[model samples]
Target: MKHIIERAQIYQALKAGIKKTGVVLPGDVKRALHQAIEKETGPAGKVLRFIAENLESAERENMPMCQDTGMVVAFVEMGDKVEIKDAFIDDIIHDAIADAYEEGYFRKSVVEDPLNGRKNTGNNLPAVIHHELKKGSDLKISLMLKGFGSENCSRLAMFKPTAGRDEVIESIAKIVVEAGGSPCPPTILGIGIGGTMDYAAKLSKKALIRELDDSHPDPYYAQLEDDILKRVNELGIGGGGLGGDITTLAVKVEKFPTHIAGLPVAVTVNCWADRKTIVELKGKDN
Candidate 1:
């Protein structure tokens, strides 16, 4: 039996999710920040504490955590047995974002054009959407609000198949070190390994939405994450890049099989704000 989803349902879910994400930091992220405070000292520790206080104030006042409300990236998983009745998914998403940004008083950061015109889109439309079809009667929307500070620090490297784990680690660490305080220290790193160049980049962005406490299902990758996290922190970038023991809060990696001759790695840097949320909508059938 096909289960139908109403346009209004999706719009409400997306709008509420966006508003909530903008104001509230995820539990895992809040915990991570608190934990870092215990491990770091000096100016870095002070900065992390200040950040924690800021989060509390934002939630208390119902204001955005960061001024850069960010460009929206939505990953939609639609079950084969589910169907939308009244409107296109993209249209609903755009409407939801427009309403959410305006209603929530989140900053409108998106522009209409990249180079020539550079006109403000005003409502933060045209979110980057990725869709997947699965075999259930529900839709899952995972949204990430990516700010330009960390987004600008993103890097991709196409390495030779001969590149070993150390080489990959060095490359990623170098990128972060070079980034210094620019991407905002104590950031979370979402790493994509293998696959083609573009797919790797997408995977990196997807990895950012994972909870900081979540471990990779694969043991090998989980160890890799630990190793990378250790190496990054050792670089001494610290909180707010003032220099300390905790440069990054966590490292999450996602891997896909790739061509025999190439190993593509992409790193998506997310600042401490790391705004993301997932909304699941079930159709009217069990």
Candidate 2:
């Protein structure tokens, strides 16, 4: 089998994934949209009707589901037996972002420097990459195109170990309520618990990749997911914040055992346009 880590191959995978997934709206989003449509009681429903039509049209056309193509986040899992032909992992991901944005005609939403000399990188290169090595030969790549609208709404809190479940639940609920209409409600909620502030936040963001319809395996946490989902809809932040139930399609929490004195929680919200895809590469013969 030809060892392939050429930038072009990476580009092809990124673009294909973007086209196929076309911004994944979770189950809670569908529920929220329907609730808002039912309760809107005015032309606001018409606005939502239009939004729905637009999403469908954009998908059918293979165009970007949203103009803000978002920040490219690549999750790379390296197989044990594969050999890269001629590229660094970072370079592959960055070039893929650049290629997809340019050739795919998606917006470049990245800034070179956040503080000084702000400049557009033009093609959205230098993706934010998280890498892990695994025990196989074929490489795997997963992606999430994170837009600032939702990303800006991420929150982290460090609580006393005694913070308890209620406190954690409230923090997430408040974030959704305050975020109202922004981040394009109804949204997916990713909760990271038990780590330090930063690790908690990372876990929350990555958890968005979980399929929207699946429940957590742990029953206790699975119940927490359902409880959070139910309460979030009660916030009345319905689809696009037009007012109704269905504020969330899913609530996912990933946790790690932490020090006895701390309870850290982080929430990352993904708008209705929750775009992600994963690809597992196979050799020519396979």
Candidate 3:
């Protein structure tokens, strides 16, 4: 078992990572955005120029990339042989979130209930955490600070086995066109393509934690991602919703084997300020 600091440290790391969102653009994403900006012939280029400049300033000053710090979602891959020492992983994670919010001076956005109670959680406790056991010795934790702007617009569809690739394409295209710019255009789409309905949704959300520029390991899936990216950008919902040639930066899809009768699909979107990071824990400290 590893004896790394408590989940508090993990929480602090997440908070720190989230704060960098729009500010510290991933190198590849930044490059792509720059290229798109340069090649544009209209106002989208201007908007992108301003965005790039804003990003530079945000990163240099170490400020929250976007005013909305976002709700924390964690994806933990634990090793079968690795164990967390002296703490229930869940409690450690919660306490870490509490401590991170306190130390980072972040906005307290989560509340007690969705409707009736409407009270603040005060410390963003009980973060959305998903755990999995894989064949490794080190624990890998990935965090994505998801904002409702884009998340609110995502959708899931369960189709009969007859629903083909064309239908999936249509659904995604309609979603992007309907979203317009609310989720902040030039979005990265996460698509979950199989499994049960709920599990598909989970996979969709999990996809958002991946690096924007990556593809699923399978080549056929990678082509699907490329196709989706092409179709989404064709929507013309340019940066911040402006009319432009590039509306989506990428499409990431993850899939799972499902019941023979079901074809489940889910889409989760990340705004321009995609914030995420991966960290690993050594023996005795996960």
Candidate 4:
């Protein structure tokens, strides 16, 4: 049975999701912050507490948690058996983002042109959207509000295929240390390994959307995540980059097949805020 979704349904769901993402921190992230607070002491612990309070205030007051509400990045998983009515998916997403930003009073951060114009798009249109087809009939949208502080710290490197595991861990740790407090300490890292350059980058960002508590299914990668995370925290970047025990909350890694001669790695960093939300829409038939 084919399930149908109308344009209005998509728009409404996305709009509400965006607004909520801008204001509310994810539960996993909140839990991590609390845990970090307990693990840290002195100034570092104080900083984590302050961050927690700010999040609470934002949620209670229904205001954006950060002034930089961030650019929208949506990952859409559409079912193969689903049918859409009345609009292109891209147009629906753009309309929904525009309305959400405007009505929610979220900051407009997108520029119309990169070089010549540098003009604000005003409504944050043209969100970064990645689409995939799945077997089910439901539409699942994962939205991330990517603030520039951390986004600016993103890094990619093409390592030789011969590079060993220790080298890869060292390379990633160096990036985080060099990033210092700029991406905001207690950061979350999304790592993409293998694949071509661009796809690796995309995978890194995609990894960021995963829940912090979720471990990689593969034991090898899960251990790698733990090792990288341990190395980062050892740097003592701490909360707000003010020097503490917890430099990063978690590390998420995603991998894809790549050419035999190349080993591409990309890292996408998200600040402690880690603003994101998931919206699942079932078809009318369901």
Best by TM-score: 1
lDDT of 4 by residue, 1-286 (tens): 7899988888898899889988999899989999999899647788888889999899999999999999998899999988887678889989999999999999999999989979998898789999999998999988899999999999999999999999999998899888998987789999999899999999998998899999899999999999999998888889888898899999999999999999999999889989888888888773
Expressed as tens digits, the lDDT of each residue in 161-217 for candidate 2 is: 878888878878898988988887667888998878778887887888877767799
Clashing pairs in 4: none
Top model number, lDDT = 1
| CA lDDT of every candidate | 0.93, 0.75, 0.77, 0.91
TM-score of each: 0.98, 0.87, 0.91, 0.97
Which ten-residue region of model 2 has the weakest summed lDDT?
Answer: 22-31
Question: Where does model 1 exceed 4 Å of error?
Answer: none
Ranking by TM-score: 1, 4, 3, 2
Q: What is the lDDT of residue 134 in candidate 4?
A: 98
Assess candidate 2 and give its lDDT.
0.75
Number of the candidate with higher TM-score, 2 or 4:
4
Q: Candidate 2 — which residues are off by over 4 angstroms?
A: 1-11, 22-48, 283-286
Per-residue lDDT tens digits for candidate 3, residues 23-44, read: 4767767876777787666567
Cα-based lDDT at residue 282, candidate 2: 51
Q: What clash pairs does model 3 have?
A: 1-284, 2-283, 2-284, 2-285, 3-284, 3-285, 4-285, 8-96
* Residue 125, candidate 3: C-alpha displacement in angstroms: 2.3
lDDT of 3 at 73: 83
